[model samples]
Structure formats: structure tokens, C-alpha cells
Target: MESQPHNDRLWIKLLVLLAYKTATHKHARRLSWSSQTGGVIPISPKLCIKATPFTQLAEANAMRFVAQHTSIPVPMVHCAFEEKGQTYILMERIEGDTLAQVWGQRSDESKARILRQLKGIVEQLRRISAPPSIGVANVDGGPIFDHRLPRKSSWGPFATIQDFHRELRSGIDAGDIEDDASSPGVKDMASFHEQAWQAPVFTHGDLSALNILVRGDEVVGIIDWETAGWYPPYWEYTSAKHTNPRNLWWQEEVDKFIAPMHEALEMEAIRRRFFGDF
Candidate 1:
């Protein structure tokens, strides 16, 4: 027999399918779409559906986990399920502009207030304890996803930070570096990766301004939890700094909110230099 939760999910899925069919000819509006990952559609004023073939149910699971554990405002997940080779997340549609949209128009005071609220939210996220034996993993203690990583696929729920670092180095051991032959930069990166790090903490993984929703000076919501997971404390800071040219201004503001991890950022730069973002 199917589990109770599975049964409930099936019922929800059926209802969602019906609603989707009905809304298609009337209320549905595509919020965002991608050829690779599917899209988000609003079927009602207060509800939306995010359907994607590339995303796992883990994204919805991460949102629910944050809602349950912290005071951070995130979209309320109505249901998440898989059917016809795609994952669908039915969620509340929050009414607010992404921080990216209003950032340039805001005064310094307004920006500071928003950043303050975000700092508190980040603190709350870090305070959540990871399950025992959890290394680097998603909310469900499974492989974590990141588009920045090569192949844009799920990586390991590594057993240890050292193991995770090894993976980051593309399976190259620190000792594999020849002191006499390897470039100074390569040797530095290998040494940096060998250093011990503090225990993993809950991380939002991607802290882009595009993901932060704001209303006036308040941070009303933080959307896009697809990359959330238990990760090294520096992961948040470094990830925030890894933004593109369009987000350069946001990257400058990152250190003001999250604690700066300069060494980690430098190490990450070295890794990227050796192995360009593919």
C-alpha cells in the first residue's frame, strides 16, 4: 500500500492537474519560462505553479524546510509532486517586486533596511541544525543542486568536508601537486583546500538580488530555494560573490550582509581559473 503522504500527494496532483487544465484557457499567465527547465505560471491571483523537468522535488522540500524552521518569508508550498517526467510545485504567489527591480530606485536608507532584514534571515538560516552525519546535502540529505557547478546537475551528499573539497578540486588530491613542477597558484589552491573548515551550516546557496522580494523597505519574501542545502559556512559568502556582470552592484553589497570569506572566495577563483565554468 502507498504511504499516507504519498496518497495525499496523489490527490493533490489530481486536483492540480484539473486546476491547470481549467486555468490554461482563462487565468493562466506565464511568469517565467526556460527551454531547459520548464516555467512558472500563475493560475490565480494568489497561487502559482512551477513546473520543471530539470528541477527535483528537493526545491519544494527546501522551501518547506525553511518555512518550518526559520522566520524567513518564503512562498507557502501547497503541494509538490511528479508526473509525466516533470516536477510541479503548487505555491502561494507572493505580491512584491524582486529586489533587483527596485534596487536602483531605492535610497541608501531603504537599501540598508532591506539588507538588515536579510542579515537577520541569513542568521536564522545558519542557526538551523543539520541532521547527524549530514555533510554537504540538501534539506532531504540528498545530493545538492547548483547551476554554477559543471554540468548543472546534483552533486554528492558527501560524507565529510574533506571529501567535498576533493570533489571541488576535480578529484585531485592535495598531495598530487608537485612542489617543483606545479604552478604557484595550483599549489596555493591545493593547500587552501586541505585546511580544515568549520562544520556545515544551512545555506540558501544562491543569494541573488533577483531572488529577494521586497515591498517598500521590508523583505517580504525570499524565493527560489532550488539551491538551498547544508554547506560550509563560507559557501553562502562565496556564492554571493560569484554573480555575473549584471549583478555586480549586488555582489558589492553581499559582504555588507553576509560575513566576508575572502580566503574562500580567492580559493574559489583559483578553482574556476583552473576549471572554467562549463
Candidate 2:
């Protein structure tokens, strides 16, 4: 497996040695003060005594995925500890610009380039064999990702847009929802799926570009898996391009950026349903 550079390892060994002799339990702190190796300055190792094993496992798995898989980039894990309520995880850091940095300056050519790259990343993610699955345990963290859905019946299919609008009014009347809850994207999807349409796909539940890293037009890495989970097929389709108001930061560019892709995903879902295999 591709591993940390030799220099980095040597550097870490020095840090470990330093930790062993510290006056206080200042392991990573003092090491970082004098650490000036490869322009890499790590955050002080967190006191993970309160972290659950589940968090450590998630960090471990994310590292493994980054190390083993070539599609999406993630951090590399060097060491980990899980005991009682305490968890310790060590991993290499990555640096890159975010996709949002370029969203605001969307030129015609830049727009096309970013869209193509985004599409390619999704296609690649679809090809990645699902990551290892972990069971529900009382422990808080682990190497495997558990992709349980957040909630069920959040939304469902509608026979027509009219039916969706009616429900929307009712929901809003009850003060349980916002007005845009009945958007064209959501309303149009009413007849397309059902409670049973949900599937088990490994997903980075929070897929916003803010969580993504970019080098030029390429998506180099995706970060922040705290909300990662198994999600339905079309779950991301709506917002992938819809540029929901929730992500107001990119709202302006999102309309043009995701318009075409959103259209394609919608039609694609329709085709799948018509094939009877859906």
C-alpha cells in the first residue's frame, strides 16, 4: 500500500520518543512546536479519552479507504487507540483548495470543466465496491462505515405534482415545514419512488463541495464523514444540482452548474423505472 514517506515516519518516531519523556502528558504539543520537517504542521493530538471506539473505527476505515482505493482520496491512519470512553487516532494530513473557491468565478469553460469533473467523481464513486460494513454496537467509532439512514418517511412519491402541492400546503399549514418544501424538484419526484425505493448505497451523506477538496478542476479528496451514511438512490439527485437554499453560499452558481446534471438524473430515474428493472 502507498504509505507515509520515510521522512514522515522518522519524524513521528521522534515525536513518540519525545512524548515518552515529557514532564506533562504533552505528547504531540511539544513535538509540533519543534516540528519543521516537510512544511507539515499537525494539530496537537486531541485528548480522546471521551471519544468512543466507534469514532476511531470510522477514522480507521476512512484512512483505509484512502490508502486502498484510488478513486476518492482520504487521510491515512498511522496509529489508533480505543479504551473505555477514550479514543486516539493518528493520521496524515492533506492540503488542497476547496471547490467552493472556484464556484463564484464560474466562467463558461470553467463551468463545463468543473461539471465534467464532478460527474466523473460520482461515476467513480459508483464503481468503488462498497466499503466494509460495521454492525450497531454501543461503541462510538471504527474503521468500517455504518450507513444507516437518518430517518424514514422523510418524503415519498406522489401520483402527480398537484398531489405533492396539496400535501405541501397541508404540511406548511401545520407549521411543520418551510414554503420551498414543495419545490419543483421535490414535487416532480412524487411519482418516481416509494418507501421501498430506498436502497443501501455507501454515501458521503453530506456531499456538498465544501466537504470536497479540489486541485484545479479535479476533485482530489472528500472530507468530513461524520454524517456519512447509506442513502437512497435519488436522495442526492435533487440537491446535487438543485442548489438548495440551505447551501446559500453556492446558490448563484448552482442553478447553472447543476441544471443540466439535475435534468439528466431526473430523466435517468424515469428511464430506470420504465425498464421495469427499477
Candidate 3:
């Protein structure tokens, strides 16, 4: 007879295989798929699953944190678990077209109304302050996730804004600027970054129109909390500005809701130029 540990391993393998089949089943509707092995699929009318090799527990935690703290509309997470190396998130299936799908056709009045609602939501997010100990972190005080970062994965719960800025500069300290003369801009940018020590606020690190779900002119849901975390005050504005070509129009509208941080934007541009926008 097989040992109990071996049987448990076999059971896990079978469960993962079954989940993979369910994700690829004919009836399942694929929401998004990576070029590699992960994607989101709706197995039933009301139940959706997001499966990815990367750990998604942080995303789930962020969503739950937002739901509890604010009145913002977000999908209800049923459960999150890891199986064989893939993380599966079972959540409510929010039904609506992405804001991107309807934005182009919307009237100026309709767009203004939607932006008003979004501004209110952003204000609510900003109102939530991070505990002093947590500093810059995910909802649960763990390392934050942002694919745009060089690491492209979890990085830090930095004790100070300066520490977080150093990481953003790819470890080039303002003091190190004297030693490394290749990038003179780093010193100025790092100094500017150091001057602003605003307490970290809850940030939806990615505010793309594609992630907002809408019904008519109403925003029914804000999906995709993978990049949500407690970050410096300027983070939301900077991240919103770093939009894709398709989202250029949305980028123009970002400052309508989020207050413009001109200096931080300049610092971000310098950081991107020197370190690359990865």
C-alpha cells in the first residue's frame, strides 16, 4: 500500500489536474489568459476562478481589505487556496462591460458622471491610512505587488518612504549619486523624493479603464486588485499616468479625478529614463 504522505501528494496532483481541466472545459468562459499557464475562467454563471502560478493570496487579501473598509464595489471573494503550485481564487462573477468598452461611445455628460463617481471612490481610498508599523505594504502588511516594478513580484513593506524610493531608484541612494556619476539625475530625483514624507495611503496601484466594470454610466465594480497596496500619496497619480497606448485617452482624464502631482511625475520620468520602465 502507498504511504499516507504519497497518497496525499497523489490526491493533490489529481485535484490540480481536475482544476486545469475545468479551466479549459468547453463551457468555461475565459476572461483573460497569459501566454503561459494561467488565466481567469468562469465555471458557472455566478462563480469565477482566477488561476495563476504566482501566489494570489495577496490580491485576495487586498480585495477583502477594500471591501471591509470602503463602500467601493468589488467582487466578493469566496475563497483562495494554493494547489500544486498554482493559486486559485474563487470569487463572485461581476457582470458588466469594462469601462473601456463604453467610454468611447459615452457622451461628455455621461463620462463626467462616471468620473465623478470614480473621484469619490479615489477619495475614499485615500482616506484610509496605513498603520505606522505597516508603512508601505499590501493590505495585510506584507510585501506589495506591482508588475511594473523591476522585481515584477513582491518587494517590500518598507519602514519609510525614503527606503521605498531607494528601491524605486533600483538601489541607487541619493548619497550614492556622488560615487556613481553616470546618472546625475538620480541625486536630484532622490532628493526631491526625500522631501515629501506624506504618510502612505491605500492605493489602487492600477487604475486602468479596462479594470473598471460598468453598467450604463454607473461603475458596477472595480476589478483587478493585484497591484493594490499602501503606497506613497503620489503613487496613485503616477501609476495612473503610466498607461498603455490604448489607454492614452484615460491617461488624459486621470488628473480629472486624481490631483496632479507635477513634481512626482517629473521624478517618475527621470526614474524611468535611467532605470527603464520595467
Cα-based TM-score, every candidate: 0.90, 0.49, 0.86
Q: Largest TM-score belongs to which candidate?
A: 1
Global local distance difference test of model 3: 0.77
Better of 1 and 3 by lDDT: 1
Which of candidates 2 and 3 is the stronger one according to TM-score?
3
**lDDT against true structure, model 1:** 0.79
Expressed as tens digits, the lDDT of each residue in 1-278 for candidate 1 is: 11011223667889887876666544334432343214566778899888755567888888888999988999998888777867778888898998878999999999899999989999999999878888888888888888778654778978877887788778889999754544547778788877887779999888888888988999999988888888888888888788554678888999889988888898888778675472
Task: State each model's CA lDDT, in order.
Answer: 0.79, 0.43, 0.77
Off by over 4 Å in 2: 1-41, 44-56, 66-70, 83-86, 129-195, 238-244, 249-278
**Better structure of 1 and 2 per TM-score:** 1
The total of clashing pairs for model 2 equals 15
Candidate 3: regions farther than 4 A off = 1-20, 27-38, 178-184
lDDT of 3 by residue, 233-259 (tens): 999998988856466788899999899
Error of 2 at 217 (Å): 3.1
Per-residue lDDT of 181-208 in model 2, one digit per residue for the tens?
Answer: 4343443334332223322344454456
TM-score of 2: 0.49
| Candidate scoring better on TM-score of 1 and 3 | 1
